[model samples]
Target: MWLTSKIKQLLMVMKPGVVTLNYPAERPPVPKNLRGQPVWDHQKCIGCGGCSDHCPSRCILTRDVCQELRVMLYDGSRCTYCGRCADICPEGAITMSNSFEIACDDKDDITTRLELFMMTCQRCGRCYEMEKSNAIDRINLKGFRYDNLEQRALVRTTSETFSPELLKESDNYKRPSDKE
Candidate 1:
């Protein structure tokens, strides 16, 4: 009776034999709706910081180097792959790619850095419309952001214009201690 039961189990296992594929040599096709990794289109991106604001994991960072220059960094290591950045982006600049294998030794291998040069209006000290129909008007922040890229910290402060004082303050931002 034991031998018959063992034989029956072996027959069931043999019915679906050799289902595993040689991963490195023969890769499986990525699904159509896979939300793997986020890809950015710099041309379409206006450095609005919408993606940074919407990221649940806060992996996205934005730093305003100057009135004309803004630096955007996307750290894939801390990202939750929620696709919120892609969805919140007004310019459709962020897109989720099908490449899911992101294992790497160095953090820079998966990091994405973008330097966006903004054209500001001389009168208002605000970003000018890139196009007649461009949605630059929909940007949430009125002026500049001073996020710390070195510390990987997001500074929620903004200035209506280029303020060196605000930049200095952001540079000195300290994390709250548990003792406090």
Candidate 2:
């Protein structure tokens, strides 16, 4: 009986079928919804730090070097691919790609960088933010939309300019007399 079972198993194995992938030599097909790794579209990114803020593994880092510049850093080794960063991005900047073979000997090999130019407020002259940000969009401000240009430009004039009284009520607001 054992011999018969062995012969039947051997016959089944002889049939042509896929056993394993010939990886490295041949690339495997990636599924549509596979969340392998995160890829950043710098053109679409607004540097709002939304991805860094939503990253659960703390793999994303955001740094404001000054009012005019912002930097985004991503580390693959620390990432868990939770997809929170991609979801929270208002600009659709971060997207998951099918490139999961991220092994590397050096830790720095897994790092990704993005740089963004910040827009200084023309009204207050102190506040700085992404060229196209939620704050500008929230008030339904016209002429500040990212419609005409592929890259949104910083509006020298904003709704804040119309409401000086509102700015005065804020904590960051400073009177000219206070400067003395």
Q: Which candidate is the best by TM-score?
A: 1
TM-score of 2: 0.57
Question: Tens digits of per-residue lDDT for model 2 on 46-150?
Answer: 665556645667567554444466566787777898787887777778888888888989867877877777675566443323354555233222212111111
Each model's TM-score, in the order given?
Answer: 0.79, 0.57
Question: Each candidate: what lDDT?
Answer: 0.82, 0.59
Q: Which candidate number would show the highest lDDT if scored against the true structure?
A: 1
Badly placed stretches (over 4 Å) of model 2 are: 1-18, 121-180
In candidate 1, the residue pairs with backbone N, CA or C atoms under 3 Å apart (3 or more residues apart, or in different chains) clash, namely none
lDDT of 1 by residue, 20-130 (tens): 889989898889989999999999998878788768888898888877888999999999899988877778899999989999999999999999998876665754323
Model 1: which ten-residue window has the lowest total lDDT? 128-137
